[model samples]
Target: MSLIPSESMRPHQENVIGSTQLQFDQGSQPRLRVVTHTAKSILVRFGIVGLARQWPSSQRQATILRYHSVSSAGDYRSPTISVHPEMFRRQMEFLSRHYDVLTLDELVSGLETGSLPPKAVAITFDDGYKDNATEALPILARYNLPATFFVTSDAVLGKSAFWTGWLHRAVSSASEETLRKASDSLIGGMSSVLSREKIYAALASQVDHAHGSKRQQRFLALSRAFHHMPPLSSPSDFMMDIDDLRALLSAGMTIGAHTATHKVLAGLPEDDAREELSRSKQELEQALVTPIVHFAYPNGHVASNVDDAAIRLTREAGYRSGGTSRRGAALVGTPTHNLPRQGINDALGFSGFVFKLEEARFSLLLRGS
Candidate 1:
C-alpha cells in the first residue's frame, strides 16, 4: 500500500532509460573519479552536460532540483539541507547563465507536449523555511529563477519549528565524533559511517509511524540521543508564515502542499493520510488566495516516506503533480505524481553543483538524506 514507486513498477520507460544510460556512463569511472577527484567532472564540463545532451527523444532531461533551507549559516543551516547564501547566489547565477529556468507549469507542459527546451530545469524548496522568504528569495529574485515552495500548513499557520529542526539542533550541538558514536550505537553499528545523515534518515523514518506524543517523544529522544546538545530553539527554526507565502506568490513564485504537519504519508492510515493532503491544500488556498496544485512527499523516499498508497491519497486530494526526493533525472514521461529530483547541498561544491546540474548520477546516487 506504500505510495512510493517501486523498481519493477517504475512509471515511465523513457525516464528509466535516460537514468540507466547516465548510470552506465558514470559506472566505469569510479577509479578515475577517485584518482583525479576532478576527472569525471571535467567530462561533464566539456561535454556540455552529456547527461542531458545524450538522452534520446521522449526522454528529454528536465531536472527538478530540490532544496530545503537557505540562510546565512546559523540555526537555519542543516548538514543535509541548508545552502549558504553565497553558494546559492553562485548556483542561481550558474543556472541562469547555462540553462533555461522553467516554472512548474512549464515543466509539466513540456512533459505533456514533448517540447521541452534543452538545458531546462525547475527549482523547488521544501519545509517552508522562513529564511526561504527572507534570505533565499532576494537572491532568487536577483537571478529571476522561477521556483516553487512546498510548505507544511500546520507549522506555518501555528508558527512552530518542525520536529526535525529540533533534532538537527541536538545533533549539531555535538562534535562529529560524538554523533558518529551515537549513531553507531543506535542504528546497528556501521563502521564507515561518520556524518549524521543516515542516522537522521533513520530518525525521520520513525516520525509518521506513530502519532501524538509518541512522535514528540521520538523527536525529543533523538534530540537527546546525541551528545546531549540542547535543541536549537530559535524562532527562525520554522516554516514561512502566511505573509511570507503570499509574498512569494505575489513575486511570481509557485506554492505546493507538503501536508498538514509534514507527516510521512506512507505510515499513516488512509483517513489520516487523506486529511493531511486535503486539509493542507485547503489551508494553503485559503491563506495564499491561490489554488494549491502540487504536493511533495514529506520525506519523498521509497523506503522512508512515500509508497503507492501515498500516491493514491495524493490523487484523492486532487493535486496535479507530486514528486519524490529520490535522486534521478526529471523525465516528462514519468507519472505526474512521481517525478524524481536531484538533491542540492553544499557538499557538492561548485563542481558537484555543476555535476548535479549535469544530472550525471541522478538515478545512480540521488539521496533524500
Candidate 2:
C-alpha cells in the first residue's frame, strides 16, 4: 500500500448538518469530494492557511512536492502519476505568488541551518518522463521555478523503456478479456472482475520487486502479450534521453538519480540495494558529468517500499538527501536521508493543491476534532 492517502476513501464534512442541508451541500458532485474540495477552498480563501503559517511550528516546517508526468496525455494505468499541464501551470503560478519556492538543495540547506522560510516549497519529478522536458519545464521556466528531475539511469541510457510506461501502454491498450488472458499466461489468471486499477497494481507489484534485468524481461514478455492490441492512444517518447538531461541542466534544472532500474530498494538485498543507489548515481554522474547528490526510493512508501535498510544504504551510497512518498511536511529536525514528500497529481486540482500544501496540519485538526 502507498503511504499517500486515497482521495476516494477520504471523507470531508463541515459543521453538524441535517440530511437536507447535506443534500444541499453535496450539489452535483459526489458528497465527499465536493465537501472536501469546498472545505479546502474555503480554508485557503479565508486566510486560514495564512493564519496557520504564523505559528512558529509551522514556520519551521517546509513542503516538498513530488510529481511524475506533466501532460494532458496522461498515463492510463496511473492517473495519479500525471498532472495536466494547465493544472500544473496554475499550481506553479500559485507557488510563485504565495510561497517561497526553493530548490530541493536549498530546502535541505535551510533544514540543516534551521532557517527554513515560512511557506517554503520544493518541486520534484521522478521517472525521467519526456513530458517533464516537453511540458513541465516550459511552465516552470515561465514561473522561474527550479525543480529536480530524478531520472532512472536505465531509462536515460535507452537500454530499456521505463517499466511503468511500458506497463501503462500494454495494460491500457488491451480489453478486460485480453488483460485476463494475458495475465493467465504471464503470471497467473487474474480475477475477471479485477478493475483496471487493481490489475495495474497487481502487475506493477510484480514488476517493482524484480531485479533490473529480470524486470525488463517481465516487462518485455508482458508487452509481447499485448502486441496484438492496438497501440497506446497517446503514444510518445516516454522516458528522457541523455540529451534531455543535458537540456534540463542547460535550462537551469537539477538532475538527480532515481536508481539504475527504479526497483523497490527495500525488497532487495543490502548489496543489491546499495548497487541500485551507487550505480545509478555513478551512471548519472558519468552521463551528466556532474555530481548526483540526491536520491529517491522507487516506490518510496516508508517502511513498505522504503525502510531502515534502504535509508542506510542511501547514506552509505553517498546521497546528500533522499525523498520519499511519506506524506508530511519536512520539519527542521527531520532525517535528511528520509525526507517526507507530498505527492501531487491530476486528482488533486488547484483546491486540492492548496489543501495538500498544508495537509499535515489540516489532517491533524480533523483527526483531533
Candidate 3:
C-alpha cells in the first residue's frame, strides 16, 4: 500500500471519512482528530465484533505497532498509513491508558527473556518524516511513551523523496487510461489486475527482487512510462532533516536503520544489501551520536518483502532486532529478526480501529495468536 504523499508525502494519504476537528496543543500546533466520527459510530452501532474486549496477556507476547506518517494529509496511496495528529493523539492517549506502552528497548528485552508486562505494546514510526519529528513527537512526549524510528538515512539527511514516494505520486497523478496502459506494460509480468494501484504495487514488489542498476533502470523506465514522467520532483526536506532527527533522539526516541535508501532488500545482491544495511547503521550512529542497534526491513515481510538473505545481512550488519509488517504480536520463541507487527490505519477511528487492532492481535485469521 502507498504511504507519506510527496518524496515529500510516504510515500500513504487518506480521506477524512466523516467530520474533522482541529485543535491546538500546548505548542499551538493544529492537529486533525476524529471525535465520534462515522467510522467509529457504525463500528459501535452495529456491534460488529468477534474479538475479545479484555486485554490479552502480554506476559509472553509483545505488540509492535508500525506507523508511517502522522500528518493532516495522509498518503494518497494508503490513507490508513498516514494518520492526522488529533487522531494520533487520541490513539496515543488510549494506548497509554489501556496498555503497557513500552519502548523498543523494553520489547527487545521481552523478546530475549520471554517475559513482558501484561498487554505490552511498543509504538514505531517508519521513514523519518518531518511530521514524526514535529507533530508526533510532542504527543509522544505528552504520554511519555517511547518509540523507535526506523529512518532511511537518505531521507533523514533530506536528500530527496524515497523511490516509494516518487512511485506513489507519479502513479496517483496519472489518468485512468494511462494507468491501465502502464499496468499492461509493467516490465515484470503482473499477476494482479491492471489498476493503477495494483500496477504500482506489482512494480514495487519487483523492486526488491532487482539488484544494482537494474532497480534504478526499471524505476526510471516506470517514471517515464507514467503520465507526467521522470525525476523525483518532490521538494527537498520532504523527509526529516538531520537536525530534526537528532532532536528526536534528544527527546528520548530510539533511532534505527531502515536502509541507506528505502528500497526492498531481497532484490539487491548480497554485497549491495550489506552496504545498504551496514552503511545506514553506521551513518545513523555517526549522525545521531548513538549506537544504532535495531533494523526494520524496507518493505519488511515474508512474501515479496524481506527474505532470509535480508535477515542474514541485518544480522551481519550487527542489528539487535528486525521488524516485519506481518500481522501478529511477537510471542515467546519468535525470531527476534523476523518479529511481526500490526499496521494500523488511524482513519478507522477510535473504537473501530481499536477493535480491528485487537482483532488482529487475537484473531487466527492473521496468525495463530
Scored by TM-score, the top model is 2
Cα lDDT tens digits for candidate 2, 1-369: 322234443354343211111111222211222335566667678765455455545567898999998988855327868899999999999889988999888999999999989778999999899889999999999999999999888878776667677677667778767887887887677647676666778888878777758976776677677776333232236788998899899988999889987789887878888888998999889888999999988888646888888889999999999999888788888899999898998887787788778765443332221
Clashes of 3: 20
TM-score of each: 0.76, 0.83, 0.76
RMSD per candidate (Å) reads 8.3, 7.7, 12.3
Error of 1 at 35 (Å): 11
C-alpha lDDT of all candidate models, in order: 0.71, 0.77, 0.70
Predicted structure 1: lDDT: 0.71
Model 1, 133-186: lDDT tens per residue? 998899999988899999888777764556666565555566766666666665
In candidate 2, where is summed lDDT lowest over 10 consecutive residues?
16-25
The TM-score, computed over Cα atoms with residue i paired to residue i, of candidate 2 is 0.83
Off by over 4 Å in 3: 1-57, 74-77, 174-196, 226-230, 233-236, 360-369
Cα error of candidate 2 at position 82, Å: 0.7
